[model samples]
Target: MEVAQFIIQILNGLSYGLLLFLLAAGLSLIFGLMGIINLAHGSYYMLGAYLGLTIMKTSANFILALVGAATLVALLGLIMERVFFRGLYKQELDQVLLTFGFIYIFMDLAKYLWGGTPRSLPTPPLLEGSLEIFGAAFPVYRLALIVSGLAVALLLRLFLEKTRTGMIIRAGVDDKEMVTALAINIKLYFSIIFALGAFLAAFGGVMGGPVIGAYPGLDFEILVLALAVVVVGGLGTLRGAFWGSILVGFIDTFSKALFPSFSMLTIYIAMALILILKPSGLLGRMELS
Candidate 1:
């Protein structure tokens, strides 16, 4: 029974970690590629949760809710990037202040639209059950979360590594001026990347809503966790994001289960150790710092 419990906990950690990756990946990309200090990224996640909840309640379709929320947030991202963020590029302080301002605006909008009550989406009927793994009944929804995260991760990896657009984006990350010199539309690229990042964040939010619920301060909570993931995973590297998410996810889940009173402390301790031992993170590029 003890062994079974441990295995279940590990599975839980993996699901949670992958979810963290979904949030961190886009963040890493924006910061690494575009050098935008978007403190309001978490607000997109909150927005998605609220929008997803509303759509799920009305349409009774989780997939549609996901699509709707992601699309809307992506548009929002585009608008913010083109109108507000474009001039602030590389001006870290200005970017931070602007995005920070948006955070409050978004939070207020959420309260006005959805009220102050917390909301949660029910697990879709198709995934509302459990599957026996090693004699323990693990939640099917969690298993699905794991699968979805992995699928998205794999697709993103391919998009980054295998596609021409991915190659250009990577080259842009390395030398934006050069790409611009080559007559590439840097502004358009930035807008697209920003929107893509927002889409990913919102998608993750929809997936996480059933588990974490939509609440007024959720943006701040998730922002902290996502920032932790980004920092631990090493800034600006997808590989770092993947491993960092898994490491932080497992540590957090296990600590909460085994040492509930010291969960927060344990996570920070682990982060401190990682920073001391591998300052660039496990898979992060050393040049990033």
Candidate 2:
């Protein structure tokens, strides 16, 4: 491949990697903080995309659509946590089963309301073109994704490290019982963490909708990928999610670009290798008891 083409592919990979990180970060956070394995997480992402499409189509304002979609999804997440997930934590298998059922229900609801057809959203006017970088032209929206993802990552790191609530969350991850015994409101923390995770997943879906058309089966496909990411990155490790997403993103993207025949299998192969070598994952710590 030409140098320009290779550079373009790398940019494409980084964009994809960033998107994966956005989605996986939420999954990692919730699992890390609450020990709740939410299968419906991807449904939240789909909701964001559908909501964004509806808002943009109705309001004809892309920024408003993003804000509206994210807010709606975050509200839904809060409701789900309070009404459902709070009680299901003890029943891990049941939580998994319940959320899995929710996945279908939410997807069907989306289909009924939006129909089974794929929907597309227009990129914002400001992000509608390519930029010349190192003599290679790359989509401006993709560069936007990279910037946004990195910013969010940094902000999250700061929140978890510098803020009081963030410190509590980190403490919860380290030892929930001790933290609770210290009189911290673990329930409240769990709810907030869940909502935050939902926000990230939903936001990722909204951002990605313009590039990857929103379709009926999008949630299921993305869910599988997210699960792979969580497992490979090690459960509940935010930093692991970042590195794992980039690794998976680059492997899948580069393989597709260079060896199209076996591209699809590369991610799974990488996951298997990671599991075999380090079952706990690259950054996974023992779950708090």
My TM-score estimates for the predictions, one after another, are: 0.96, 0.95
RMSD of each: 1.4, 1.7
Count of backbone clashes, every candidate in sequence: 0, 0
lDDT of 1 by residue, 30-58 (tens): 88778765788899999999999999999
User: Of the candidates shown, which would achieve the greatest lDDT relative to the real structure?
Assistant: 1
Summarize candidate 2's per-residue lDDT along 209-251 as a digit string, tens digits.
8998689999988887887787777777779889878777788
Evaluate model 2: give its lDDT: 0.85
Task: List residue ranges in candidate 1 displaced over 4 A.
Answer: 286-289
- Location of the lowest summed lDDT over 10 successive residues in candidate 2: 280-289
Q: Model 2 segments beyond 4 Å from truth?
A: 287-289
